[model samples]
Target chain A: MRDDEEMGRITLAQVAQKAGVSISTVSKVLNGRQDVAPPTRIKVERLLETHAYRRTARSSREAPLIEIVFHELDSIWALELIRGVENVAKANQASVVLTESGTRHSPDPDWIEGVLQRRPIGVVLVFSALPQAVKQQLRARSIPFVIIDPAGDPDPDVPSVGSANWTGGLAATRHLIELGHRRIGIITGPEDMLCSLARLDGYRSAMSMAGLETAPELIRFGDFHVEGGYDRAMEMLSLPERPTAVFAGSDLQALGVLEAARVNGLRVPHDLSVVGYDDVQVARWSSPALTTVHQPLRQMAEEAAQMLLRLRTEEPSSTRLELATSLVVRKSTAPPRAD
Target chain B: MRDDEEMGRITLAQVAQKAGVSISTVSKVLNGRQDVAPPTRIKVERLLETHAYRRTARSSREAPLIEIVFHELDSIWALELIRGVENVAKANQASVVLTESGTRHSPDPDWIEGVLQRRPIGVVLVFSALPQAVKQQLRARSIPFVIIDPAGDPDPDVPSVGSANWTGGLAATRHLIELGHRRIGIITGPEDMLCSLARLDGYRSAMSMAGLETAPELIRFGDFHVEGGYDRAMEMLSLPERPTAVFAGSDLQALGVLEAARVNGLRVPHDLSVVGYDDVQVARWSSPALTTVHQPLRQMAEEAAQMLLRLRTEEPSSTRLELATSLVVRKSTAPPRAD
Candidate 1:
């Protein structure tokens, strides 16, 4: 299975001729050499993409590596994802290369150069979208990649692993409803994220299914942070007819809700019940603990890494895999107080 | 300078000759090939160690990697330290290789083999002690290593980075004392670790300086976890003469203390002031935040990684560098009631 012959597509020689460059020059551009002229590099790159050239599988002597890239390494989800990838890498006798680069949508352009030079076994990205040029470059080198898209937005052609945000939202709302609460408030995440919208929709569906009228004032958008949760919860708590319970969207936001409840002289699970999303470590450490939706973030990372390995060997069974989310009952939620 | 030509040290040829093996076999053993016979490998290893054999520095074309190994990846400290090394790696155009391998004192034998093959620019270990054999293996490969020892126990000869544990403890206790906490309980970390002893000594010194009688019943040893804090705090709160405040040795333990106070129907700060150590992210996320000591974990990691880079080019000025710790006043501590 040689790379140049497998697809029966136009070979590198034809692409080199089309781009008016020597085969060696085309090879230099493919290998990410800095000596190639910028215009010639661009032309060769276009031809490679057009021809869908795939390099042969790397030799066995190459250093075994699995690269994981994240836009924001400070997120609480980072450790779990890293651990998951590390586990698989160890099992395969591969080292894990970590990089915090680029914006939320994709990794920085410079990052691709390092990956090309390293010639890692595969890459696992924690972003929702990747630019076409980046995708083309990775494909041209036969370096497989999979996205761990927690944001619930995935490109149709890309392989991705995500959790069921909508079901999580529904499960959380239903738990509160079952606890005899009718005036329910929700502080969903940022409006731009698809996962946030999905969760919000799930909350609305749950409320409507239970024959409860959701007031527009009870619905608010948060930034998935403690301060955002605090501000939104404070506003909702100050209402003339405050809700008995609130869904704080994320664990950080729920922590803010707990503080807001404390500021208003309300004890958790006694005066007001609160539910959180993403059962991160803090969920268990919070003073009263927290009743949250358990998103399989670590498992998602493992699956994404596994998908990359599978892509290296053969075609994957599916382009997208969505794991289920479940509700965890902790001390934070209970029946509303009878006043 | 070439490795064999430097320092007038014994060369690989001498090592292999003494071990009664071929030069190629000794080279295979150095590169971590698994095909060598166990007896032959052991003999070759001993010869190399006795001679202090060092290989040539890796070629410039080799993959740019900086390795960081941890025995436990779940600690709250992991994220910050990873970020620190990642920051430096990015600036230097190098990628970080992360591994969760080995025990509390040293990495597993299998880990060094991969590190050898990867030929990282250097390694940053998060353990208190490493075996002589592992150290020799790394040195022979010319792979510089530095320890990020928060444990406060470090090998005198190895370059290491650590923070001031004793000072951190003293600062935390002094802050509580200044807030009118005369009878302060202290729950330091596990007894076996030097850091635990140092912090406890600091607490004792602070109490003695303040002319306060250190009650034997008020002092305890914890496991640096939330549950240990909760258990110890619960016991203290149940005492016939409970202290007005408690010094939780770690933020995780401090979280435990807060929960224990809640279970006992005591209000934090108002009824019993609390102070925590190692102001990790959870310290700020905890409700009412936490009045704790900032351990500078990220900075320590950065310094350790930088030390490795320095060792690669030239000798480090010092074998050990200890950063200072300071108290952060949050909402967790306040003056006790005059009742």
Candidate 2:
């Protein structure tokens, strides 16, 4: 499928002809003009919402603008992605326009309508679940989209960029195990997120390899934010036989666990050990420095941008690109104290 | 100046007339269509780049998008501002479109052109120096823009939102003074930044009020970032007779000072006291937490958004808004120990 035909183009003339109205009436309805009759307006409005109207004919003079959609925009994690995308955009002479869905995992119903109106050359979605309906709408308009760290199991046909989350999770747990830790706990991201499930599976794989039963009580689902980590860590720490080491799904969550420990008077490494994912700057800035899995977030974003650019230029490329993750040893993890 | 006239709407016909070509020839040039004479194409393209062609008649059918431009998108500091703007935007049924200047303090020269092409209802600039030419262009297009924490001395005519940095700086320095530290070192933001200068002035005022001579060698200009704090603190700590306390320009800077102390094997509060500005979350997560000034970044952002919205409605309002900052005493400060 070529880029421009993704959302099968809907022309105003066609819409007007189908609605039995003049082009001016259709235009008025589109412009939200008050002069259109209510019934004609409703008919035109529904068509606009349900279909994409291509404006390329009159918009030939505008520069290529790329639209990046985020499930939410409140994260330091986004800074890396923005940097990578902006780097690519500048080199290509394209300007980026950012939109937030406001939801954590999906966009509002009319997001496609707004996106199509702008006629962006390409789109990048971060931590999102692209519903089939939206996907169909995008495909119909020929607007190629690439997902970065998609939140759920993405459709096989979709293009995406991600980190080796399972490997990262495995390495994190294995490091703790090598440090002579057992009874390890894991804080994973939202249950529906594929990366979260992959990380948890890796943890379970590590535990199974060590001949330890996977204890349900030691596993907690988190939102990959500080508060989520804090709340879950608080619960696990209250258990009669709490784990001596914890593997957090993300660095932010890891910081939360550290705070929970502090509140409970447990010194890191001295009384407990902790590991986190993402290895964001905060992980290094943590007092003890955090031992975390570096997800190459910026690299992933660059790759996503490159992939989208290739799609725009009609170059052949792989649909999915999963970058490697590596373990960064700082000071947050150590052997558990003698019992 | 009314919003929408900032770019002074131009049309394809106008470009064609100016280029001495047929309207079709200009339209082809705008669309990147081949077959036009090279010289004629160049003339038409130049006109298009320098002019604003109103797409509002066709774009009015699109949903409202408000543009938010940031000098750089590199820090978690932006999250608070994003949350605040997003909250208000949602309540008012408006969606935000974000852009970054890439330059640390100034927007790209062509930024306003792209923004006007998009026809956003309003714009909000964060830590930016809006050039006079751009301001005139925006005003002519009738586009309203409000600055949030302007990066430099904003033009008097521009509406802006800022924190009471002078007061915040005074409180930070005064707190250290009350803790019985006579020799105090200070770090401020970039040399050209208005906020940075105001903070340094505040520090000087506090020292003068305390009857302590402000030593030139003890002051350093910083960029309100971690690395800046680290390098400056390292130098201050190496002085033969170093000050007993340091006032960091920002929270990230304060963390850098902490790191510096760690490198020199100096225990915080016990050997050196520190105070920071901008009470971001990192301030609370630092080992001893951080004694810092709480700048109302989110509130300032909300206020900026409200101010822009008012401009979009052509309502009269104050041109400058300076919100108060307060001292947040945490664990990073203490009385100097007896030598």
Top TM-score hit: 1
Interface RMSD of each: 1.2, 2.7
Q: Which candidate number has the best DockQ? A: 1
Spell out the clash pairs found in candidate 1: none
Q: Which lDDT tens digits does candidate 1 get at residues A1-339?
A: 986467557677988899998999988887777798988988888777666677765678656899999999989889999988988888888889999999999999888888888888899999988888788777766678998998899888788899999999999999999999999999999999999999999999999999999999999999999999999999999999999999999999999999899889888888999999999999999989999999999899898888877777685343889999999999999999888
DockQ of each: 0.77, 0.33
DockQ of 1: 0.77
Native-vs-model 1 lDDT? 0.89
Q: Model 1, residue A114: displacement in angstroms?
A: 0.2
* TM-score, second chain, candidate 2: 0.81
Model 1 C-alpha lDDT per residue in residues B1-339, reported as the tens digit of each score? 986456457778888788888899999988888899988887887777656666776777655899999998898899999999998898888999999998999999888888888888899999998887787777666678999999999888788989899988888888888888898999999999999999999999898899888999999999999999999999999999999999999999999999999888888878888899999998998887999999999999888888878777695443889999999999999998899
TM-score of each: 0.96, 0.77
User: What TM-score does chain A of each model score against the native chain A?
Assistant: 0.94, 0.81
Position A211, candidate 1: lDDT:
97
In the range A1-339, model 2's lDDT, one tens digit per residue, is 975488566788988988899999987655434577877866776675456564443255565677777776756567677777877876776666666674765577666666666666788888556676566556545577888873435546678888788888899999999999988999999997888999999999998898888789999999998889899999999999999999988988898898788778787877889999998778877766789999887887778887888876574333777889899998888898887
Docking class of 1: medium
